[model samples]
Target: MKLYIAEKPSLGRAIAAALPQPQKNQKTHIELANGDVVSWCIGHILAQADPEDYDAELKKWRMENLPIVPEQWQLKPITRTRAQLTVLRKLVKQADEIIHAGDPDREGQLLVDEVIDYFKLSKTKKNNIKRLLISDLNLPAVKRALSSLKANSDFMPLSISALARSRADWLYGINLTRAYTLQGQKTGYHSVLSVGRVQTPLLGLVVRREQEIAAFVSKPYYQVQAHIALTSAEKVAFTAKWQPSENCLPYCDEEGRVLVKALAENVVQRIANQPALVSHIDSTEKQQAAPLPFNLSQLQISAAKQFSMNAKLVLDVCQALYEKHKLITYPRSDCRYLPKEQLKQAKGIINTLANSSLPCNKPAQGADTSLVSKAWNDKQITAHHAIIPTEKSPENSSLNTFEKNIYLLIVRQYLLQFYPAYIYQQTKVHLLIAGGQFLSQAKMEKQLGWQVLFPKSKKAKTVNNSNQKQHESEQEKTLPPLTKGQTLHCQQGELIAKQTSPPQSFTDASLLAAMTGISRYVSDPAIKKVLKETDGLGTDATRAGIIDLLFKRDFLQRQGKAITATEVGVALINALPEMATLPDMTAQWEATLTAISEKKANYLSFMQPLTAIVTEMVQGASQQSFSGLPQVAFKPKRRKKTFTKKVARKTG
Candidate 1:
């Protein structure tokens, strides 16, 4: 009998439904018409054993047992999942063939592979294990995956990569945590001092940003503004900003803001009540494509901004939509581009939305399907495409408020692909007044196009905040048709003083972007280039959890949406060595891990460097001093005194 083991029940049901006439059995397993059995795992049935599991003596924190590297890693069944493991063990023992149908990511591969390894190592080795890789959990996707089952051995490299990551994290977290805690104890401080591969580096980002903000000193700047009355056929007035002159370069910075108050006042006096000439008038038409679909990080950023939701909450919502409602494709995708082949299914998916309960009306429905942006390139697609709606129409689906909002966001992006580019005409006028040059600008919308879909949200997913500022600045009061050498009267001029502000604290939106593209924060050019080749800090699936873990450990605190490192967090960072806090370590590890996943490198090749790094860290930590850390009142339990004091009491 053939047995299919899925990562979760929702996926198992989807796969079973794709088969012909699958029936529900007594133990909740699905019996296929072809006499196959389908079972599911909640996630991981078995996990890496904790330190105490290896040796009871290791339970007590000690400096001598600093680097707790496990010679032979062991696995134990999770308490709540043991019953499910027993069922799977029985099914695995009887099956002639086993099919592994986990999620199509590194963690997913490990989840199923570990369960099989548990029984295989203890019992008999089987050569009949097959693997199914599916990006979506819908029926058609399931059927497509089932038709091309690969030998389980083919994905052993991914499993190895996942195992290496787990073991490496275990070694680093276990050893460093104990080393720090024991050191802290000597200084009369007692806190867990929890640390991890990704969480520590992430906390370092927050601490550094906070330090930068705290050390920043604001400086005053000035700009001269002019209100000019156009000498046109009709009465017209507009505002213009004074431009930098040759002598003003020392007192002025980019964006034409002058640092000297006297210079700005002089410019205003010179330009005030003077006749102005239109030295140049330029207008250029531009086109902007709609936003690309959401990868997990982008979606998390948007959700955080629009709904004030955290990254983990956004991931949960997207997961529900994908696994339970079957409304969207996979949620843990890193690619923001879709496969070219998926363009064929775009019409059907859109047609369903057009006819479904979504608020899309005639104009959105009339979007032209022939002109999707270059985001349809197949080569850009990673393990999965961007999150988009499945063919399953959510007409009567029971969706909560959060789900509906996120679903609408996805649908809006998908509909935008079919719409024409947003078109506008940008106008800039350069005016010469007295002794200074002034400039005015305006943007006239030629067509709303795809902008109509996300009427209030961002037009492009990857457009940075700097680009957004430029787009906002391009839009101003409509400029009257003017030609070169046209004369205008300066109605008024004033010196507006402003202060240069420090960088703002990170919200979830900015933090997620930074984590996704962390190379921006690194100072080393070689490491920056290396980090860019490998996507930033942590995988999309793991970054949210890393951030969440920091909060749980009191390493970070949130006020409204702004995140800041706690006192303990900053001190903890100072307590550790540079190797523990720098992004280069994780970045290099990720690059090597990628090589391992692609079969370019083996586990030993990848681990040798990490082993050295860990050893160096342990050696350095032994000599490091920690003091005045946030104190924890740790009172060791008093042992019972079993001396014979009874005889003394009787004599008294």
Candidate 2:
């Protein structure tokens, strides 16, 4: 019988439902009418060989042996997952043909590959064998994939890359954790000290910010403002604000009030004589495109900002949408655009969710146009397009508040493609008053277009808006009629006091943003152009997890959504060479991997260097002395978080 191995049980069940085979029975196994027996993995049934797996003596953690690199790696059942392994063993023993079905991304590839390694399936499968790569489990996609299944050999390099990364992480995660934990034990703190390549680097960013905050010395600065009446207003209105041309003034300190008044009177004499003139009128309109589809990083950022949703929660909900509801495409996609072929499904996708979609604040632009965006490239779209709804009505009521928000964000963008681009007019006018210049700025929308998709954010920015002061919409900054040479009456107004503000601290939302777009950060012209053309080191699926891992390990701490580094994180970053923490290291690694992916470079050649470097990291980490470990003492926020995700319902 043909044995079909699916990534998970739910997927296996779906595959069986689509096949002609009836029940081929085993514990948690099902058979279809076509005699294809299908079984699934609960994520992973096998894992990388740990040092403990080598022998009983190796199980004990000791520094005497230093780096424990196994000459030949062993495979074993995941202890917590052996229940599923038993079922897999029964099927693997009897099947004539084995179909390798797993998730399409790197992680998915790794998981399925591990199971096959555990059973040594590749060496035995010399007959009719195939592996299906699929992004989603919809019937059409599954059928299409089955008809085109390639031999397991087709993905050997990808499998090699996956295994290499896992082994590397094992060497890194196990060695570093043990070494660091032992050091903490030596120092009298029994806390489990964990360190990782990405985790430590991420923590360093937070700790650095925290240190900056702790070391900050507040400096007070002075500024001036004035109140003035414009045109024919009977009463003086609005705060006419400007700094003196001299840029300095004297202030009374305690008993110096009289001394200050004497200086102020002289300065007031000079201020009263000068005329304020409108020097220039300048206004321009810009179309702020709706953000790209929700990449994992983008989703994390939006969830944190819009619903105060945690990164982990967003991933969980998305997994549900993909696995349980089967209502959306892949959950952990890095790309925000669909492959060109999927563009044809646009009409069906729009119709399926016609009822579930909400009105966008601004109408979407460009969906109907034949003109396509670079985001929609076919070759770049490896497994799937950006996360989108399946071609069926989403069971809207079944969705929770936050899921609803995310799904709507997807729909809004998809629909937006059909709309026109945002159009607006900008106007700037400057006038002259007395001897000084006054300016005005305004924006008027010619058409809302796709701007409607990302509605005016409901999250309000708190400001002191009193009726006594005109409450101007942030969108509307109106200016009075004025010309470049326009003149205004010179009127003396009160000088107002303001202080210079410190640079804002990084928020989780902002930190993710700061991490993207390497081209913006690179100073060298050549480097910037190169980065602009390539995908950065970490994929969308991995970056947030890397950041979250840092927080979980106490390398980073969150105070309300703001991330800060702990002392340990800061020290670790400083301890490592500067290149270790820079994203370029990851970029460099990815560049080589891409070369392997394209057959331009051999996988072993690319990995051989990493193995040597990792060997040093593994062997050397245990002996390296650390001065101290950082402890995080943070108070959690008390306010209840607001959320906007709604559970997506399954359509019958």
Candidate 3:
């Protein structure tokens, strides 16, 4: 009997349904009329054994076994899902051939592969094992995948990388958490102080941003504006603001916030009521391409920014859309570009949208199918394509408010690819007034294009108003036809005083963006370069969880829409070593992990350096003396009990 093992029951059922007229066998396993078996793992059935599993003495938190590296790594069944593991093992024992039908990512690869290793199936029954890779759980996608089963050994690199990541996290997080918690205990603090590879670094970002905001002192500045009126043949006048030239320095700061009120008053007095000549008027047509489709991180950030939904919730909704509703493709994709082969599927998807009663706003119902965009390059496609709607139409589908909003977001982005680029005419006018250079700029929308699908809300408009006010001289207005040397009246001049604000506190959107583009945060040029080559802080599949972990750990607190680091969080960063909290160590590991994925490095090669670093961190942490241990005098809040034994999930 052929057995198909999937990551989860939903995926298992989807696979079973897609198989050719498969018959349900006791609902435990689906059997093809020709004798086949289908079963699933409830995520991970077997996880890397915890330190407690290594020995009884290790169970009690002790600093003596500071750096516990398992000489022989152990795998044990997750207690909650041991029954599922039992059922899977039984099927594995009976099946003539086994198919590894897990998720398409590294973790997914490890989920089933680890099960095989747990049962000692690979060493004994290697010849009959095969791998299946599928992005979407849709019937057609599953069918397409069934036709292309690869050898199980082919994904060994992915398995190796996943195992390496888990083990490394175990070495660093297990050892360091014990070391730090014991040290804190010495200082009368009793808390399970966690440490992790990506979680600590993420917390550091929030803490540093909060520090900047707290330490910031606003400085006052001033800018001179000359409001000018221009005339056309129709006797109608268009208003324009005079922009200051480069010489307006000493009067302004680096951000162009005018710093000297006296200098601004002098300029306003000198230029007020002066005849302003249109020295140069230039108009250029510009086109802005539609945004690329939603990768998981991009979608998370967008959902957070637009709707104030947290990253974890957005991911949950997207996953529901992919797994439950079946209205969208894969949700955890890292790639924002579609494969060229998927271009054929785009038209059908567009037609489906056009026919369906979309969940988008009323104005977005009419999607333009004629706008073929530039996001269909195969070369840019990664492991999976961007998150998009499946061929299945969501018309008349049952969706709650959140699901509706997320679905609409994905649909709108997908449909936008077919819309024309946002076209506009940019008008730049350089003016001469009383021996001072002033500039005026304006944009006239030629075509709304894809932008029509996503109209900015009032809040967004208010936020953009600052940008508009920043370029005070370039007001958005219709420019009347004017030639060189044409004189215009400067109706009024005013010196406006403004204060320079500190960097804004991170929202889920901004923080996720920082995590994704972490190279910008790294001060080390060499490390930054490597981080750029590898995915930052955490993988796309893991970033949302990392952010969620911070909230759970009380490292970050949400104030309205902004995220601020807690005092405990800041104290933690101060207490920890830079090697543990900084992005450099994790970045180097990510680089080596990528090398492992690309076959440039083996598990031993990657783990050797990582193991050494973990040893060094544990030693440093053990010997180092911390001041006061950042005692937050409050009882730990009661929440859902979180499992900490898993190496894959940790928050430092």
Q: Which model scores highest in lDDT?
A: 1
| Candidate 2 structure quality by residue, lDDT tens digits, 1-652 | 8988888887887677667845676667887766668898987676655565576676555666546566787666767779888878878878888888887666676677777667765565733457777666677766766777888666666666666655555555565555555554554534545555445544545555566767776544332333344533333333343333333224533322222334434433444524545567676665544345666667777777777776677787888877777767777777777777777776666656554444432232234545454456677676446777666566544877777777666666566566666666667554344433333445566777655544454211211113213223434454555566554443554433333334456676666665555455445676666666655535566666766666655567777766777666666665454544555544555556556654667767765676676556655554544556554333222110000000000000
Q: What is the lDDT of residue 406 in candidate 3?
A: 92
Candidate 2's C-alpha runs over 4 A off are 55-57, 86-97, 117-131, 144-157, 221-285, 356-375, 428-440, 457-474, 480-497, 500-508, 514-538, 547-558, 564-602, 611-652
Report lDDT (Cα) of residue 129, candidate 2: 56
Task: Give the per-residue Cα lDDT of candidate 1 at 605.
Answer: 84
Please, what are the lDDT tens digits per residue for candidate 1 over residues 53-162?
Answer: 78888766677776777788888897878999999999888888889988877878888998988887333345568888777777876787899898887888888988
Worst 10 residues of 1 by lDDT: 643-652
Taking every candidate in turn, the Cα RMSD to the unseen true structure, in Å, is 7.3, 8.5, 3.6
Q: Candidate 1: what lDDT? A: 0.79
Sort every candidate by lDDT, greatest first.
1, 3, 2
Clash totals, every prediction:
0, 62, 3
Candidate 3, 1-652: lDDT as tens digits: 8999999988999888888774865555666787888898989788778766778777766667778888999988889889888888898888888899888878888889889878886564776689987787878878888998999788888889988888888788778777887777677666767789889988888888888988999999776777786532223254444455678766666766667777778878987667778898899997878888988998888888679898899989988898998998888888888887777676677777767766453433455555567888888764578899888878767988889889888887788787777777778888888888787777676787777776543312322344755333333356777788898877667778778889999998999988888899899999888888777778888888888888887888989888998877877788888777777778778878878876889999888888888788877875656664666453342210133475444423
Per-model CA lDDT versus the true structure = 0.79, 0.59, 0.77
Two-way TM-score contest, 2 vs 3, winner = 3
Q: What's the candidate order when arranged by decreasing TM-score?
A: 3, 1, 2
Cα TM-score of candidate 1: 0.89
The candidate with the higher TM-score, 1 or 2, is 1
